[model samples]
Target: MYKKLFLSCIFSLLAICPILANGELDSCESEVKRLCQNQTESIKKTLACLKKNHKSLSIQCRKEIERGVKQEVQTKPPTGMLFSGGGGLGGRFSFIPLIKYQGENFGPLGSDDEDKKTRLRRQSVEGSTPIGKIGGGFISTSVRYGVTRFKEDQFLNNGTKVNDKLEQLELGINFNRPLENKKNINIRAQYGYRGDRIGGSDYNYSLMTGYSHPTESGRGRWQYFLMFSNNGPLGSNIPIPGVMYFYRTSTMNLLLGLPVLSFQWTPENTLFSLSLSTFGPFYNLEVNYGLVDQVQYFIFSRWKQENFFLSERRFEEDRLNLYEKVSGVGMRSALMKSSVGLELRAGYSSDRKLYLGDGLFNNDRGSLDLSDTLFLKLMLTKAFR
Candidate 1:
């Protein structure tokens, strides 16, 4: 009986050893699969996280993952990143280029022939950049080139027709420094050169110191500006022949004035402004007043997968004592990605003289005249990082 029992125990041990071996093999396979899945998931998450946080991520890590996901994201570039700030030195500098043409009609009424005048104009690109910021004040400089023409009608002297033209090239610089934390109490200086076709050139220089104080409600503001200017001819030509009388005489001119009230209203993409100023000569103290108004409207839209913007501006100025008025309207359009644009403008001006003729000898000259102008402009721009 003892021999039979011992043989049965041996059989039972052999059977259990095979079952334990199979279970161990299955567990090892399962552990290998879990580790492989975890690694794959981690790599995918790292790539997605890096792109979402471009500035926060480490450079080395981003580069490594970008290689793996290049195919998936390459076809789809980021939107709203190109031309983000409208193309400049990363918010530093900007420029404006313009071309214009003007026509003028001046003559005595009821005359058989009316004098017609025309001008072709071009101006250099103008630009501005911020230099530095100090405390509550900032400094900026602007440079520009202005070219224009003035046509003179020939006088009827002995029935001989003569034509005269005035051409000018103006290079200008403008500098401003603000004080008192309000942009009030500022100083400005400017210098320019005017070249004439007749003979010599004129030099213009001016310095202005001004201040403004706005009421608490901001509905009304008052400003006072004092300006000193020098206008005279340059070069070795003393008593230049055929030069305008005003150019030959070197004079120190003074302008003192107060801008009484100004108002502005802006809603969404539209802006409107109006201002009235009362001015006079500081020496003779002649009283004169002027009114200026402006309005701008703009719209932004997308069509045919291209972004576009359009704007229009209307400007008007009236001088009461001088009896002169000018008004103009302009329109501009541009594409989103291209650094090209088109502009059109039209203007009308009328001038009247209260007193005219030879140095207090002739009678008062009263004549009404009209002028019209049109302009087509093109622009080019670049951006810096």
Candidate 2:
């Protein structure tokens, strides 16, 4: 169990760059200078211009640009995993509105009191920015904050009412730079600090340092990386080592290794695709169909877990953890010239468990099994280059 938790922590530590096959953008330099003379300030703008005029471009330019776009879509990280990347071309911000969870009573297990219905609400916001460039790479800073609130309708068997609210905040910075002379070899580093409860002793720091090597293959590229980081959960204080490999083609991208396995595929010029990823104790599966270049519908299922340090002790333990399995369908669309995005999701949350103890496997303090419920979420996002 400790090994499993350690791998989950390693997932956050590994710094993998989804560098598409090189030469695609460089090969179109002349075309950009000719067709997009006014939008040469940034790669994002140049790519947009190329896409807008795809039908009129030279055959080679059009083909390469199309391949680049498909690879970008296939490897782009999900909003929730924004801070996981070592570096990014542009930055993004995401916010999830406050949502409630309700269905049955939420008290201690094997308790006869059915009147202790609890009101639970949750919300979160996160963003990242590139501060500067170093060795032809970008250095990025990221922040994430979230809050969960709980209120009980009546007093439980114990004298105190159940109010195990939690707040989590994390700040991070990361960078990826190539070796002095060998551009094929890259060095990556990241540092993060998480404060489980503001002004409490539940804070921890994480550090990761690694290097990656990319080799050219037929119609694709292969990247391999190795890293070392601090452990994932409490009571473990050793640095762990991990390794991962990534392969990308014009239509498919795959990352295979311990603690992380991701696969994404899209047919050339098609509207449907599928993505599946698992890291540590977390996993997400998605099937998407596009209506237009900027809008899509999807079905997804995922497992999410959160751990915290409580300010006040309800039992003998000072730690609390929650895990939930969710399945849902949603729609997302890019608007405002593809700089803004909105998503609406409705789903069922089941197999929810909340426990307290020193760690995940050692939950001897108390545990609660929550009843299944339906949930809805509205997320808003903005991108800046």
Candidate 3:
């Protein structure tokens, strides 16, 4: 993954310097001198005059000017005005409206032994800034909380079900420092806790860190990045890479790179998206759509192949192979007022692949089979733009 991220970063960096690429600025050097003949006062004034004569600028000069103008416009928002949670990659930070909140409830998907219930709920709030630039470096950080509940067969002596609920606290950050003209370094890290309601699994935690280059491509309209995080089976915290290409047109956005491929059409109040089997799109459209679309009538179904783990140590024991698949279809609708939206969804899932793994119930290499199921979801999100 790290290797792929590094390669993609290199390619995306190549994608950013359109001015230097075809010598756009070089081709327009003579134009700048000709247009601002009497103005040797300052580079800023000269550029301003050039912009005023924008209509008559040559193609290359216009392209270069447009790129700079686009970036300049964004800078007007003040340093910490904006941040992204990574396309479904959970992120935070913003300047204009730096606070955001989201909450979602996942319907019960199946039953455990003795037929109780398994359910989940999640909520998170994130804040960060693009305005925190200090000595050419800036950082964006975010935190989140989530919980899950399952029917754990039986209860403990205190009447509290042991290991019946899973809770997590998450933290993440993205930092950058300029390297040279039009290039900068990108670094990110995340820590998560996935424990039970009453101190269930002490081994339930994941930590990852990544490094890459921060780049803006697609004619200066979007940011593209290549990143590699160290959390694979082997806990080596070394840099490896993976990439996802980003291109934002007036109507649609496309992202494609090894292990990552997806696209979304965002013309207005409506959005249509498709996610591939690669790393880029997996939960993006599926999960995000379920989370974002609240105003329209929508239907969705997915077949997910998943691995079940009792603890992180089970990974080393090769016991992580407990295979499971949940195929479900759902319909959703949304109600909105300004920046706040509420989404509701209901569906049915086929849990036929629940127990397709390798081991028995003691260690549960494979899990138990679940018949058919019905579920619902309610989500509320507030956008601060």
lDDT of predicted model 3: 0.36
> Estimated TM-score per prediction?
0.38, 0.68, 0.52
**How large is the C-alpha RMSD of every model relative to the true structure?**
29.6, 9.0, 11.8
TM-score of decoy 3: 0.52
Q: Quick one: RMSD of model 3?
A: 11.8
Model 2 ranges off by over 4 Å: 1-38, 41-118, 134-137, 153-162, 179-196, 218-236, 312-319, 336-338, 358-361
Kindly list the per-residue Cα lDDT of model 1 for residues 137-203, writing each as its tens digit: 3343444443332344333222322223323333332233333323344444445543333223344
- Reference-based lDDT, residue 315, model 2: 48
Per-residue alpha-carbon lDDT of candidate 2 for residues 25-112, written as tens digits (9 for 90 to 100): 3444455567778875655555466446534555444333333333333332322222234222121111111111112222323334
Candidate lDDT scores, in order, read 0.25, 0.48, 0.36
Sort by TM-score, top down from the best: 2, 3, 1
Model with the higher TM-score, candidate 2 or 3: 2
Q: What's the alpha carbon RMSD for model 1? A: 29.6
**Per-residue accuracy of model 3 over 168-208 as CA lDDT, tens digit each:** 55555555554443344555555554344324443222322
Residue 107, candidate 1: C-alpha displacement in angstroms: 15
Each candidate's clash count: 0, 0, 22
